[model samples]
Target: MSLLKKFATVASGTLMSRIFGFTREMLMAAFLGTGPVADAFNTAFRFPNTFRRLFAEGAFNAAFVPLFAKEIEQNGMDGAKRFSEEVFGVLFTILLGLTIAMELSMPFLVSTVIAPGFTSDPVKFENTVNLAMIMFPYLACMSLAAMMGGMLNSLHKYFAAAIAPVFLNFILIGALLLAWAQNYDPLQIGYALSWGVMAAGVVQLAIVWFAVRRAGIKIGFRRPKLTPNVRRLLVLALPAAITGGITQINLLINTNIASGSAGAVSSLVYADRFYQLPLGVVGIAVATVLLPELSRALRGGHMQEAGNLQNRSVEFTLFLTLPAAAALLVFSEPLVRLLFERGQFGPESTLIVSQILAVYGLGLPAFVLIKAFIPGFFAREDTRTPMIFAGISVVVNVTLALILFPRLGPTGIATAEITAGWVNAILLLSVLIWRKHWDYDAGLIRRIPRLIIAAAIMAAALYFSAQYFETYLSRQAGLLVQATTLGLLVIGSMIVYFATVFAIGGASLSALKGNMRRRKKAAATPENTDISA
Candidate 1:
């Protein structure tokens, strides 16, 4: 598939998932607000989620997909299948034990490890523990799902894995509505959301399993053994886990500090959700599609092709992520208000969440760049270097959060996160250059200034459009009007940004247009011909 087509396949599904995720969060805010109930729920959810990112997104996929892709390239389908089964067996055993232990020690884990937010209130603390126990098993389910997703991604089947997240968001939305209809207590609703998470995990696992079968890859449990391939996977995955762990520790530190501040944790969660929409859509989509492809190119010694792919991935990521960052900075308030300002969510909550979103927006590009760049290292099986940079970034994040949280509250935490992201991105690039692993070609160098110019135009256009449209988005306005005004601001900004880019020679309209045409043509071609070349 063409790069653009692969990107579209991943981006389209991710965009849908993000939209549903937004809807789910909106319903959650309406029902729970940023009150103690919201606090407990967000806290409980983050516990399993932090680990989910560590194991599922961070450790497993980072180490697994590239290795799996290599096995397929070197040994054939059966070799790859055996590798997957061995890893799956080991993962199942480990996750089962971890889940049981975590569930049994739920109270202590909630009060100490996860949410120090509950320390001030006994009832809130207990509710958080209860919800966490109910949710901890989700970690196991999602871990397996992520493993399945890694397999699908290695097989170049991006759509199913990308769409799996939408099911999760939809399940949560359903649970929220059901809770509302039943007039469940706020804490009860939180538990229902927890159950929804588990359900989503099951759905995602099923989807990917079916996709794998269709791809003619049969995966099954086998006798657990530390075979050579499994041992190699463990060795590589350990550093990834540590790297992921360091990053999670930074978040946990912020969470701990936010815990000390009333409602700060929930505010950060809401703000993060807004930023994650773009991060998920652009950053994650690129990482998901690029990693396996990069792995194959590198293992096959196709350095030039790998470099070209890397450059294109960076260009594409900037094309999408820059506009998203601009929009978030421009319309943080309206976006927050339109989506979350109802029921228990009040004006104060909106202001706080919007502030956090703006702060996160400032670092959105850096975050996306990290996603695009890290695959360069991971595909080459170089986890230790990224781990070192991650450690440094964590220190930056933790220290800044500690120094700023006392002064600016949750917004300070958000600012610290952005700063840390930039720090990490710079460090990664510096090391890559130092090692001569990655260097921008003349074309990439030429494109940088043009991209920056385009991004600046986008920022200016979005800012003014948002200012102009705010009056039409009054607090008492109907939801339709509020949504329409928000849409107009976004659409107008996009038109202005594109027009400015085309006028100023900051972007190539014809090149992009032609790329799309090529992708459509390629997609229409026979599958055998598509792969043979």
Candidate 2:
């Protein structure tokens, strides 16, 4: 399949997941609000999520996919199966051990690392520790699932792994409904959601496991052993783990700093859910498809193909991400208010969350660009370079958050985050160009400015449209009225953005369709293997 088709496959799944995610967030806002229970639950969920990203998705995808793809190329599916079983035994054992240790130390972790500020209120602290213990085991399920997902992605079965996350949102939404139906208190609702998270992890893992099996790769459990393959995976994964979780690490810092203020942690989490929609769809789809594709190309000594892949990935990433960033920047308040400003999530909550959402908007492109650029290094087995850059970004985040939080509050933490994001993204791209590993194809260079200009025009249009609809967006307006106005703003902005992009030559539907046509033709004729867009 063509790159665009592959991206669409993954993105379609992600967009569904994000839509459900928004629904889940809206429910949480109405039920839990930005209360003590909400803060504690958000902290608990973030803890396990941070570790899952660090140890599972980012780490394994970076270290395992390339090696697995190479094994398929060099040693066939049989060799790849053996290698996967070996890594699974070791990964399972490690995850089991880590989950046990974390559960045992849950209280200390909640007090020190997860949310020190919660210690001031014993109720919040105890709730966090309990909730975290219930949810921490999710890391084990997800890590195992991530290994299977890496296997599926390497085998070109993208839809299953991509669709697995939707189950998470679906299950969580069910939990919220149950809580609401039962008329549970905030604490009881938090408990339901925590258990829901744990259950979702198992369901997600099972979905991917079945996918890997259907892909004709059945991995059996074996005694844990440190074979050459497992050892090499560990060597690469350790650093990649750090590099992969850079965004979560920075957000953890933001959460910790924000925890000192009541409702701050919940506020940051809400705002984060807004920006994550685009980042997950565009950035993740590009990264997931690009890494394995690039790795196989490089392994086959297709240097020009590798460069083209990198250039096109960047172009595609910006084409989607630029307008997303523009929408978030221009309509943060209306979007937040329309979706979340009901029930306990009042105007005050909307104001704070919108402010933070706007700051995150500025960094959305940088965030997606990092996803696009890091694969260049990972496909080449250069994990340490990105790890070093991630370390620098972390330091920048921590320092700036500490310096600014006293004055600007949670918004300051958001500022620190974006500043660090731009820093890491610039460093990654600079090193890629400096090493001649990535070349800015003239097409990419030309289209970038056009994309930016198109996004700017769209943002200006959205700004005016929001002004015209201000009365309907106010707090006094009914929910249906507010939602209708916001929907129109979104639809009109999308129309303007796409029209501008196509008009200014930022993108080409004909070129995209032709590229796909060529890919399909190449697939039919095995001898015609060149499928460049």
Candidate 3:
């Protein structure tokens, strides 16, 4: 398939998941609000999620996908299957052992590192620890699921893994509904969500396991053993675990810092959800496709094609992310209030979340661009470079968080993150440029400024729309009225953004549609047998 088609497939599935995610968040806001329960739940969820990203999705995929893809591209099906099963066996064993240890030590960890601030309040501290223990086993399920997902994505089976997150959103939404229906208190609602998280992981694992089976790979339990391939995989993965985890590390820091304030962690989580909508749909989808595709291209000695794919991935990422950043920056308040203000989430909650959302907006493009650029290193099977840069970014983040959190509150946490994002992105781009791995294509270079200009124009339009609709949005209107006003602002801004992009020559309608046409041609092309350089 063409790169664009692959991207579209992944993106379409992510779009479904993101839509469901929005519904999930909307329900959460209603049920939890910006209260102690909300803070506790977010803290608990962040613990496993941090490790899930650190070891499972981020590091494992960066190292695993390229090697697995090469195996498939060269040695064919059986070779790939053996490699996968071995990795799967090792991953499962490790996760099981780690989950047990963490569960046992949950209290001390929570009291010391995870949420020290909660300790002064016994209720919050106990709730956070209990909720985290219930949810922590989810890391085991999701870690295996993430490996299965990488396997699926390597095989171009994007739908199953992409849609697995939808199951999570649905499960949590159901849990929230059950809590409401039972007239459960905030603490009980936290329990519901915690159980829902573990259940969702099991479901997600099953979905992708079935997908890998249908794709002609069946992996079963085996005694853990580090064969040569497994050892090599671990070697490549260790640095990547740290490299891919910088963002999450920053988030963990922010969570700890936010814990000092009552509802600050919840505020950060809510704002992050909105930012991730665009980041997931565009940046992550692009990154997922780019890994296997670029690995294949590079292995086949298609340097020109490799360069073309990288450039286009960046173009595509920014094409969507730039406008998204603009929308969030301008319409954060209205969107937050419209989506979340109906229940216990009052104007104060809306104000806090919206402020963080706008600050996160400043970092949206950088976030996506990092997603685009990191593959340049990963696809080359060179993770050490990114690890160094990640280390630098981490230092920048921790320092800034320490300096800012005391003064600016949760907004300071958001600021630290964006500043660190730019630091990571700049370092990545500089390394790629310095190594001559990514030379800016004239076409891409010419379009970036135009894209920025178009975004500026769109931002101005959104500002005016938000100003005009401010009074209506601020009133104690019903959900329907607020949603309608917010929808108009969104729809209008999208129209203006796309129109301005086309007018300014940032992207062409024809080039995008041409990708659709070329998809067929790409499928017909002979497979390149050169799978190793």
Output the number of the TM-score-best candidate: 2
Error of 1 at 464 (Å): 2.6
Candidate 1's TM-score? 0.95
lDDT digits (tens) for residues 105-220 of candidate 3: 99998988888989999999999999999999888888888888998888888888888888989999999889889999988999999999999999999999899999999887
Candidate 2 displacement at residue 239 in angstroms: 0.8
After aligning candidate 2 to the native by TM-score, how far in Å is the CA of 386 from where it should be?
Answer: 0.1
lDDT of 2 by residue, 307-384 (tens): 878888888888889999998998999999889988889989999999999999999999999999999999999999
Residues forming the 10-long window of minimal summed lDDT in candidate 1:
524-533
TM-score order of candidates, best first?
A: 2, 3, 1
Stretches of candidate 3 off by over 4 Å are: 518-533
Model 1 agreement with the true structure over 1-533: per-residue lDDT tens digits: 67666778988999999999889999999999998988888888888888888887788778999889988988899899989999999999989999998888888877787776677799989888888887778888888888888888898889988898899998999999899899998878988998888888788888888888898888889878899988888888877766645445667778877988778888998988889888888888888888888888788777867777777778778767787887788778988988999999999999999999988889999988988888888898988888888888888998998899899999999888889889989998888788877856665566666667877787887777666666778788778999888887777778876776567655566566545544433222122111110
lDDT scores in order: 0.82, 0.91, 0.86
Q: By the TM-score metric, which is better: model 1 or model 2?
A: 2
Q: How well does candidate 2 score on lDDT at residue 89?
A: 94
lDDT at 332, model 3: 91
The alpha-carbon deviation from the true structure for residue 453 of candidate 3, after best TM-score superposition, in angstroms, is 0.6
Poorest 10 consecutive residues of model 2 by lDDT? 524-533
Would you estimate the TM-scores of all the predictions? 0.95, 0.97, 0.97
